[model samples]
Target chain A: MKNFDVYVKKQLLEKYPSMVFFLVVMLFPHFGAKAFGLFFIMLFSLASDVRQKRLDLMTFLPLNRRQIFWMEYLFLCLLLSTTFFVGLPFAERSIYAWLVLVRSFIFFSSYFGVIISAVSIGFDPYGAAFLFLLVDLVLGGIGSSQLGPTFNPYKLISPVYQANLLASLVFALILIYMAYRLFTQRGGER
Target chain B: MIRVEHLRKQLGNKQVLSDVSFTVEPGTIFALIGPNGAGKTTTIRCLTGALQADGGQIELFGENYKNFSQIYLKERMAVVPEERHVFRNFTAKDYVQIWSRLYSKWDDTIFSNFVARYSFDLSQKVESYSIGMKTILFVGLCVASQADLLILDEPTQHLDPTVRLEIMDMLKECASSGRTILISSHEIFEIEEYATHFGIIKEGRVIYSDSIDNAKENHRIVDKGENLQASDVIGLVGSSVLVKTKSDVGRYPRLNEIVVGYLTGHHERSLSLR
Candidate 1:
């Protein structure tokens, strides 16, 4: 746990400037544009091991590949989701809007985090982004399928229903778990 | 403290590590040396678990590598990878603090002493330091971690002669404390002074490996003008031949000579005493 915390600090500190810039961008009213940029910047940040090519180095530290992967995801989620939830004032007034807001936050972050795990396992991030874009457009079902009436930031923002926040959270958690399982089984080799 | 057997890895179309094997007992400094592309880095990668080996076994501290807990193995070992392994944005202080907190064995006295010895401001960003300075900082922290085993690759590359000597002395001290050290370096002469064992690689295969004393005993450089014909004709001078003969009559080959001879000389000889 201590090692993971140190790793999180190092990862965030390494990309501090870009992270700060993205956070500032999130504060603007252009939620759609900001989120789009967020996808690239956040995913690029996922390449924490790419720059130093230190996947091997990290193995020498007191952290497993799974722990390292989890911390990175956690760092990105905490950093980006905080920005996301801060925009909740703009959410529409609907039945249990607060539940919807929290659910959507968990759901979208995990969804995209799973999508980026491929990049962590050797897939080029830009190429992964392109593939992700293709899949999201083609399947039209796995991600943000129903842009509910209460969607605030964008007409395409996947909105949560009344008390279904638990379901949404459960769904994303399952996907995240599966992603981590597959990642570790591969031995974290690029 | 370390054992590798028949480790093999194929990267894309090339066989980067083919049948590599070596063992390092506690308190020994083993130098892994080879020509460029000889798979020194690949071997280190496999041992560190950075790259999974396609075949063979590795045992660290008598624990089968596959069965050992990742955190347990990591806590007992530390590595200074090839190049650019530093967090550029972090100041020296930040880098040290991170490792200090992560490892229970971290020696604050050593860390502070190293910082003072290096005489660099801890507040400066790591990227702002020269490459040599970066090497000093990284090596200092790894030493401070006080791991049971230390694996370093090209650790002294950018360092000056003075710093390199200091670093080598520090590593020797580390080994004296019962720690094991595995180093891969091109600075053959420098390592020869401190390394107790050697694993010489040639085109991805381990050609020569043994305790430095045993290596010296098992291999010798026949005087160039010797009248004897030997099987391993490793090098040739103006009027003499360098032979890897086990003959007690010939002088022991230095580590540098053995490395060159294995990489370039022929291994065919018929003995004739001078």
Candidate 2:
């Protein structure tokens, strides 16, 4: 636990600039633009570490792979969620607006989880970004009757209540859990 | 204490570590000497858990590594990876603070003395330090961690000759204080002067491993073309042949002789077979 704390603190200190930038970006009025900005901000923050091989420094410390992965995820969630929550009252008053904000956060987190996991397993972050774009397009469900809204990333942000926020939250948690497993299993190679 | 048996690793299409095996007794400096791409770094990576092995066993302190807790293993070991990387944005003081928080046995006095001896500017960012300074800084950190086991990969790569000798002496002192050291290096002459034991790796395989004294005692350098069994011969040393013999007929081989003989002999034999 001490090691975990130190790791979290180090990460926070190292990426505080990015964190501030993320907070500023979250203040953008449009939900779609905010969600889009959040995705890239989170990806670039984490991907910089992966691409620079900074994770190697943490691996040598007392912390295990699981601790490192979750610590990174924890900071990402805490920082981004805090920014979203703090800015909520000033931006939106209605329960429906709140639901839209929560849904967008959840969907983007789910996508971020997948991309981060791929990056953890040595995939190029730019390549994973391309992968995410493909998933977003498919989830847009453009003229596809077979592909439904159950897992559609577009529904959560569309503001039409096509997808349930609770269901999206659950799906996001599941994807995050899978990402945790994948990182712990294969993340130590470098 | 460390023991590795039949360890294997395949990176991409290359079998980086085909069958590496070695052991280091407590409080001994065991040098892992090998040529470039000979899998020395790969073996070190596997042992440090940075890379997983494809096959075989590794035992640290008599406990199987698979069953051992990595946190526990890390708590007792300090490693200086080959790259000698640092947090580019952090100052020396920041780096020390992080190390102190993470390592339970971190010795501030030791680190302070090192900083003082080297006159390192604590306020300057690590990225601004010269290559040699970065190497020195990590070496200092490894020593100050005060872990029971120290694994350094090319620890003295970027240092001046005088500092290299000083670092080697410091490592010698670390071993004298009952810490086991496993160093993977290409500095044959430097390591020969300080290492108590050695493992020579060639082509992803451990060709020979033994204590310096025992290796010298058991092997001899004879004139080339001496009548010896194929298995008894280790390698060639210029005009002489190195063979495992006990008849008191040939001069004992130096550490470099043994290493060069095995690496070059193996290379020649492989070429002849083709």
Candidate 3:
């Protein structure tokens, strides 16, 4: 009945074990591990959908391509928000901790956006992940310098001043919007 | 109730559906027939909005499927897709309950009747079901939802002849009760039995569509010996002439003969729509 609700529930069940594993792993201060876990979950979800040819089953449903993309985006946002809440107290309410949270939110949103866009645009989950990894590595290499802090996608925790952090936040938001545009074009490829 | 015009779709390097066009009148059973890889399934996909068309229009219930919201379209239809597999996460009963709540016209009594007919246990997990049982459960759910339009792809594909016959009766009842049925089936004999209209598709195009009577009336089966030198020979299979120029034809042709005439021998020619 509630198609979106059912879809979210189904995805949650499919990835429950991995999610729990990531949640526990994030309890430690290692943001890189948690980020990798989150990315893995994203890739796994897309891979399963692609492998099973989910569209063949979904075509009979009333969902259009944009709706399908929105469902995926909703799922990603929910999972990310829930995990972030669970980790909120660990920072001990310091401004330093708030900065980490802000930066992580921006960084994760951008990564999620790109990954979903890649999968929606006909890349297999594996291919998308590897391509994203390659691009991030190249960008990090270019940005590495004392003059400008490197834009290392793998880094989750580090000191960031307000001005640059805000700029990064704006850039990440733009990427999220662009991913929406690309993901909306998905469907009918099946 | 259905009108399709110049629907086109390209997948990967191949154009899967091209310039396909047809219509299904209200309460009419339109059987979309074709050989494997002849685009019957693709046509069904485009019609159901599972796959979008690159070009063309699809109108149903006086609204274009391409431009209308999916919720508006779904409110009037129930579909049984080609995939017969049921999700292992839910029991058949769970799905029935979910759909019953989803559709405004769902009939619980009808749902119960179909479950009884199929002898399905709602308590059983879907993974425990055989392929045929899964299909029966899905079909039952679709039928009991009480939508006005039913779009089914290969609905009777995996069933035994007895069950297939039962389904034929069920669909006939649905049609006679005023539902518009669009079905794509390879069971030529089954289509011949119940379909009031027919459309034969090949390589992404609808080659022919007409009433069953009209299709039969327009084509003839000639003995190959008599039509060997005839320039109008449509096709020859073994010792039989599957099709030839219209005349006082030598013999009555079955629907299968007419279909084979298009698929086997007409591969190199442009679409010849009747």
Candidate 4:
């Protein structure tokens, strides 16, 4: 398992430098906080594995399928956590920045889980990416509209963004669990 | 010894392997032969434990493979898959080093010797090596591991005739050293020359498997009399005898006579011909 981890990390490090450069250019300075690009970067990197068929190699290894899945999740989480720490000084030294960072990581991880599950079921990476973007945009629009004039802190519709973030985290967890189940089931037959 | 019993697998609606079973003893090279889409690779995948068998069991070295840990089983085995997928950026030496760490029995001296003998450029990235060179490196890794069981699928798929023969000789040498080898290939003639045992799979089943000499003796293409149809024969000693051709009242009576004469040696010559 440790060797496998080292192999994955080695592969990532070999490609991450160039990817970070591309991400930096695409989502330049002061774009809804630098951390916004981190989510996209994580998603793209995970999706890149799907596109290249590197994910298939995991199934061939001796480790449990679920264990492999969680390792991938942890690796992504570590990347997100590192990005958050690096961006902490850049964002104003306020609790909001920290909260946003945590919330974003949770939301991004959950979304990634759902997307990876979809990919496992024969979803094309580009199509899945496009669909994810469209769905997020629609949900974000709906939530922003609900948080319109005269926002009440105690109302069901109030604190709309936070509620959406919480919902995203819940859905992400569910999707990841489902993805884990699906991969394990398919792996058993392999 | 390696024993596979009732191994079965399905992918989507297609049944890849059904009730596949075979046993390979130590110091012997077994060739698994089949046409394309005949489930050769799928069966190999299951035996290597890369893919799970939907049903059945695989015992390697007198123990259930599933009961053993991955590292434990993998330490004693190595595979050279049909498609050689080496890490593109890593040089041949780096690939060897990485695999060496994975297999406890890996021999660095043997690896270095093979590298030198094969004239592989350790400095060049694996991606830069030609297909044949990549195959050489893949085989080198298997050899260096010193694993008791070596499973290869189409190991010579992309090599020139000379290199392919060299690889086959290497496998023979490995087997002679008391290791077991199970290889699947479409190259029948090459397999016929080196393999001690033969397992011919067709459409996900082991239609025929036995020692090479026994298989030859068992699957004879007997040409009978023009009026005596080949399909009409019953209680034949072998599995199946494919009839290549049959003609009536032709110049081939001597051929039929020759086959009948051979069969008489095994059976009662007094039996009346129809």
Candidate 5:
């Protein structure tokens, strides 16, 4: 518990960058489209801490591997959820807006969760994260076409279709479980 | 205080440690001596719980290491890792505060005095400090932790001669106070001066291990003419042959000579096999 407190404190020391993006996305409402991009970048940075040998510093401390893994994953979740709520009031108050927000959260969270797992499993963090981001962009572009409503991942998880939302939720949970399993099983370094 | 048995580890495609086994009695300074790529760092990493052993047993404080909680190991031991990494964003003052919170026995007064004595700027970020300063800061933090055991990997590397002596002296003092110290280092000459016991590792296996005095007493450098058994000869050093004979037949080897003899013997044996 003491180690967790210090670990969180260490993370807060670098909160400036994340805070800056949060404020920009919240105050300057027009930057909403680019907000996801900035948020992903923040997520990439946080996930890459392990790759940067920052985890090596903690390994010397009192924290165990499980605590390190969960603390990090939960911290990212907190950041992502905070960003989502801060931009909520600016929503268009339509089903489409709600679907876009929820689906984007599910998709990106699962995507970055896999990235963190990949890094833990020995993939170079920079290459894996960027490649995943590129894949997300390609999917988003494809989903934004004439068949946008049907194919668009950001529009697919709608409340109208409980099955669709439920499937997405289940898929996200599975991905997260897989990630945690891989991370905790792998050795600290390659 | 620390015991390792048949410690094995594999990193990527290489089997970094094969059978590293040693013990450090409480209050002794045990130096792990080996050449580069000889598994010293891997052994240290495994001991610090940074790298789990693929197959082996490690016991600390008379309990199986696997059975001890992570916090328990950290609470009783302080480590100065070979990487000497720190949270670069933090200042010295921040480190003191954070480490104080993390380690139950952390002594702020000790670290504060160390900072003042070294004239280090407590407000300056660690990233701004030179390599030597960073090493000093890490060593200072380990000392201030006041743990019962200290595991340091090359604590004197990258340091000036004066600072190296000072740090060794500090470690000597720590050992004298009943804290066990385990260090992996290439500074054989310096380690010879202070280490109470040592283990020589080569190619992932501990080839020789014993107390300093016993090592000297057991090995001798003799002329090449005597009918020495192949098993008794340790290594060839120029015209002289190092032998492991208990009889008082030749000049006793110094600590460095014994190390060189064992390593050179291993090199020759490998070359002949090749």
Candidate 6:
């Protein structure tokens, strides 16, 4: 499995330039507000590449389908965690900074959601990205309207956002588990 | 030894392999030959446990593949698949290091020697290597792993003749050292030279499987001095016959020739009837 890890690392390193660019943009003041959205998009795109390449290699090695799935999940976690740590030092020291970090985690979780949804529905990269973006946009719009203020943590603008942030984190964990199972079940077909 | 019994695999509506069964003896070279899209690669995938078969069983070294632990089975076998897929960003040395960790019995010295012998640059990224170079690298990795069984699908697909010969030599050396090899190739001539046992797959079925010498002897082209339809002549021969051609313009007028081909080439030794 060490060899397999190296293989995954080599692939991740190849895509490091794009990752760095995404991180830099997220750190920039002008783009900081939109960082969560961009991060969500980038995660799905990068995860798709990772999933496909790992699947291809699994075809050659004497590995079972389950091992391949777990390896990929582990790789995804490692990559996202590394990127998050690296970007931490550059974040601004303010209330918004903590919010940004929390939002970024939510964004990352949503990307996993996209990946799992894609696998479950057999959607390719383009379709998965489009679906994720569409869902996020609609959800964002709904959360901004007059009808949404009652449930809208964003409009409350203070302590409510913190509560929503915690809720979102919990929701993300649930989704990650669901996605892991869904993707693994679907991956057997490949 | 590797044994497959009644293995069946389906990809949606298409049945990739049905009731495919064969066995490979230790220290022998078993060649699986078939045309493109005949499920040769699919069969290899199933045997290697990369793709799960819908029905049937694969017993590698006495344990059923489905029941066997992946790490345990992997330690006993290495596969060089038809598609030469490798990490493009990794150098040759890096690639070898990664492979070494996968196999419990990897030999770094032997792998290094193979790299040098293949004339591959250790520092060059895998993406920089040509198709032939990539193939050589894959072959080298399989050989150096020192696994008991090597499963290669079209191992020499894109290699030049010289490189192909070198690979064959390497296979021969490995076999002599007590490693079993199962290879599939479209090049009949190359397979014919190296394979001790032959298996042919056609449309997801094992059409033929036997020793190479028996396959040649059992199937023979017989010339006759009379032109006749293939269907008409089929009843006259005791064994299965495939008619080469039926034409009336030859010097031997009314002559018809039939070529005998074996379905399995498993019959006992018989004296030449011709």
- Cα lDDT listed for each candidate: 0.71, 0.77, 0.71, 0.64, 0.74, 0.64
Per-residue C-alpha lDDT of model 3 across residues B81-143, encoded as one tens digit per residue: 777755446778767766776677899999889887778888888778888887788788888
Pairs in steric clash, model 1:
B224-B240, B224-B241, B230-B269, B231-B268, B231-B269
Best-first order by DockQ: 5, 2, 1, 3, 6, 4
Least accurate 10 contiguous residues by lDDT in model 5 chain B: B265-274
For chain B alone, what TM-score does every candidate structure achieve against the true structure? 0.91, 0.93, 0.92, 0.81, 0.92, 0.82
- Best by the TM-score measure: 2
Better of 1 and 3 by TM-score: 3
Model 2 residue runs over 4 Å out of place are A17-19, A28-34, A94-101, A141-162, A188-190, B67-69, B225-231, B267-274
- Write model 1 residue lDDT over A64-85, tens digit each, in one string: 6667667777776676566656
Residues B163-239, candidate 4: write the lDDT tens digits.
78888898999999999899988877678667899776766776557787654443334434333344323223233
User: How far off is each candidate at the interface, as Cα RMSD in Å?
Assistant: 2.2, 2.1, 2.5, 3.8, 1.8, 3.0
Better of 1 and 6 by DockQ: 1
What residue pairs are clashing in model 5?
A: none
Worst 10 contiguous positions by lDDT, candidate 4 chain B: B249-258
lDDT by residue for model 6 over B205-267, one digit each (tens)?
Answer: 776577776544433333455444442222123333333233332222111111113322322
**Under CAPRI classification, how is model 3 graded?**
acceptable
- Winner of 5 and 6 under DockQ: 5
Each candidate's number of clashing pairs is 5, 0, 0, 3, 0, 6
**How well is each residue in A52-146 modelled by candidate 3, as lDDT tens digits?**
56655554665655666667767766776666667777756667655555655665666666676666667665776677667665544454334
Cα displacement (angstroms), candidate 2, residue A130, comes to: 3.3
Which candidate, 2 or 3, has the higher TM-score?
Answer: 2
**Candidate 1 vs candidate 4, lDDT winner:** 1
